[model samples]
Target: MTALATAPTARPRPARAWRAVMRLHRPALIFWGFFVSVVSAVLLWAYGPGGNAAAAAWQRPCTVDLCDVGYAVDIYHLAYRFCEALITFLPVLVAVWAGGLLIGRELENGTAELAWSQSVSPARWLATKLAVPAALLTAGTTLLVLLHRLLFDAHQVPKGWNWSDNGTFEANGPIAVAFPLLALALGALSGLIAGRALPGLIAGILATATASTLIGLAGPHLVPWKTSVGDLKEGYAAPSGVIYGREGAVTSTGAHIPDPCTGAGKACPAAHDIVGYYSEYHPSSQFWALQLTQTALILTVAALATAAAFTLLRRRTS
Candidate 1:
């Protein structure tokens, strides 16, 4: 009688289902692990303020500065800086969610009958399956952001220039958040909607790639608008005298009369380089706010995916 009474129970928590789902994603996990390991080291090494010698070999004089000096940064900095763009591609990779082939996998393998006959309920089973991937991905993204902040300053001033420019993601703060969320959602959506694993994977990848391309092209207008004094029209001034005119003690030097555009040249000192107008460019706080908002939106997508898959599973015929 006790054995009979103990026969009934809802599925073990969603966690078991979540783990089962994760088992199918070993390839993706490997890819992520390899990527994180390789990229983390690269980022840490590349962002070091100083490293590598061959970079000095690439330095060159600027055409607008007052001196012959040029901007300076090591080759590693350039490499690390390139990492900033990685967030954009994250979406394409993340779109492979557990939703696709989740029900389909069970149906195809004919395991739903045996599994559902046990203590698990459909919703709980689905919920548990999605938790692992979602949590791990989010954690990974957070770590990446912290690393970015730790190794680099929000506002960067390059050498040979006092201008507070060349900063990271000054253009769009939301970019980071939106892309990652987009990736995760896409993955899950593809997996769930595209029943077959291959098809679902492709759909996720393609969707992410498409969005990434559009954002890359149009992100400029969406970010912070940092004010800059770079738009002023410049004019060079010539010497006041023409080579001393061969008389009267040769006291006068070159004379540069200001001209408008073509007629707009200032009398620049001989020691100085070319002078030009610089446009005023400054980033607004809205830039960061927008980015943060975008991040939230993305994260929400992941949560939604989990909810959606659970709902679908609960109503599944199998």
Candidate 2:
């Protein structure tokens, strides 16, 4: 009965799912926007007026070549503080928010059940929750990182704040982005496992802190280091921005020994017949290569956490 050729109505599942996630997490969305705005303003000030002031201060009238270290310290500390916050503490904030506000709170308050009942399966719901926040987090972190790189490269930032610094290393590269995602996934897994907002938040913070410590300790080991062997008299001078690893002395008999006596005055090398000291280091040129490798490792951790989260979600819902 070719009654009437009727087309099937389209169901905007993805769009609706996105909207539902936004609606559910409106407060978090607002808070994230506000935080990003504040950080952006700080970066802008550093890039513009604050930077100009620092330069002007550096140009202080110097007959004997001495300048106002206090003024410079004041100007630089603020910028350093901001960078430090982003690199060191940003992941903790992400984990807390993801655990307490995003997933845990919803599960705690029973809103998750209500959402799931309304045409959203558990997997789709979890995916939307993670996807939306992950996208926002990525955008925000990338912007801050770019601004940091620009400021540092332009020499607007202070000395002693180089790529090798823990805070600077993270804020200057892609690992900055990866760490936060790992935090988010860990937070979600924590929330699902705890099933309580506050406990989830606490667990997430601890997990993120542990991850950061592990990553920092593993930093130099992430890539093969370049080895340099020089006569002990030449001394061990690592390349600028290179992460130095093991140091040892080599004997004239071709035997490698560790940490032999060194210094322009030390006689242990002559007594022991040491020819040279060898040191392992990763040069500044390896920055991006090592950064990407660490990022891959972090993302792998996040992926595993997300998979575990999905499995847990299935068990809970079933």
Best by lDDT: 2
lDDT of 1: 0.50
RMSD of 2: 4.3
In the range 191-280, model 2's lDDT, one tens digit per residue, is: 988888999999999888888789777877989889888886686656667677888888898676876464535777888888887778
Candidate 1 residue lDDT tens string, 134-200: 5676667666665665555422323321112232552124345456666665566566565566777
> What's every prediction's RMSD, in angstroms?
13.0, 4.3
In model 2, the Cα lDDT at residue 13 comes to: 55
- Model 2: colliding residue pairs: none
Model 2 gets an lDDT of 0.82
RMSD of 1: 13.0
Give the number of the best model, judged by TM-score.
Answer: 2
Task: Please identify model 2 stretches exceeding 4 Å from their true place.
Answer: 1-15, 64-66, 69-73, 253-256, 260-267, 270-273
The 10-residue segment of model 1 with minimum total lDDT is 242-251
lDDT of each: 0.50, 0.82
